[model samples]
Target: MNFGDRVKEVHREILSTPHGDLPQEFVTEAVWRGEAAYFLGWAIQLFDKPHPSTFTDPGALTGVLQLLQPDANELVPSARLRAHPEIDDYSALCLLIRHLLQLQEMQAGGRDSLERAYQSRLAKLGLSPASNRLEPGAADAVISSTAKDSRGLYVVRSLAAEWLLGEEE
Candidate 1:
């Protein structure tokens, strides 16, 4: 099946499940595939548009990205999305979405606000963002580190920022 069909099937399954009882494994799989499809769709849409001077509203983009961010472990592979490149691209897109969202939040209300928004967004996705944090000392270290460790996330974020700022040629 194509991406849209797969997403539809997964959405149907998720909707059919009883509230507060969705299987974690199923949710993870669904989220992985769904995020891939969502970003792929956005990529296509952005491609079709004529190059604009700048993104009309970065906040809107941040909101969409926040909503699309998946709440699953990156190591977990989705059965439906078996291609390595596809998975990598999807994960990178997710990371960029997160990075941009954090940036926007930080600009608005400093580090504390960013942390709160990040936790709140994850909670809305039914994921525990707190669990991902390291110990207080380690957390500070990680937070202070540059974003260069993940090549995929960095590359995606760079390209996205360029596009958002209308620097794309």
Candidate 2:
């Protein structure tokens, strides 16, 4: 299915059930859809930044979905997109996703372990916690992250990256 059709279906599924009523697996898929939507929205300047969490900020996502012509296969027009993806933003988001994937690997880990692992990784790179620079492409970082999560958001972001970068080339 094309991006527009796929996202519209996901959006419909998301709205079909109320939050608390949806099954956990269903909710998880919806969260992934939200993440994908957020990425595309940010890419098109629909928002200034990706939503901080997978679950919050539905309004922004809803606005993005509403902009699509249902079942159109095509992405938002080029005129709506930024001249290009900001390398810093792309790298930072990818780094965060990579960190989350690593933390997710640890057995029965929680938020605390995530923070510790993040700091340790930062130290290893000689980067302070406040550092904005990130080393990019830790080898199939997108596939690795999406594979671990079983959610489609990372894949969507990767597709967005390819779509945008493909245009550049």
Q: Report the number of the highest-TM-score candidate.
A: 2
Model 2: pairs clashing at backbone N, Cα or C within 3 Å: none
Backbone clashes counted, model 2: 0
- Residue 74 lDDT, candidate 1, scale 0-100: 23
lDDT tens digits, residues 49-146, model 2?
A: 55232333666665555545463334444427654326335634544665565556666647687788666644453334323554455434544444
Q: Over the full model, what C-alpha lDDT does candidate 1 score relative to the true structure?
A: 0.39
Candidate with top lDDT is: 2
Residue range 42-150, candidate 1, lDDT tens digits: 4434222211112223233324433223422221233232343333333333433455545744665486766776555444433343334323444234334434433
What's every prediction's RMSD, in angstroms?
Answer: 16.9, 9.9
Give the runs in model 2 whose Cα sits over 4 Å from its true position.
Answer: 1-11, 51-54, 67-75, 85-88, 91-169
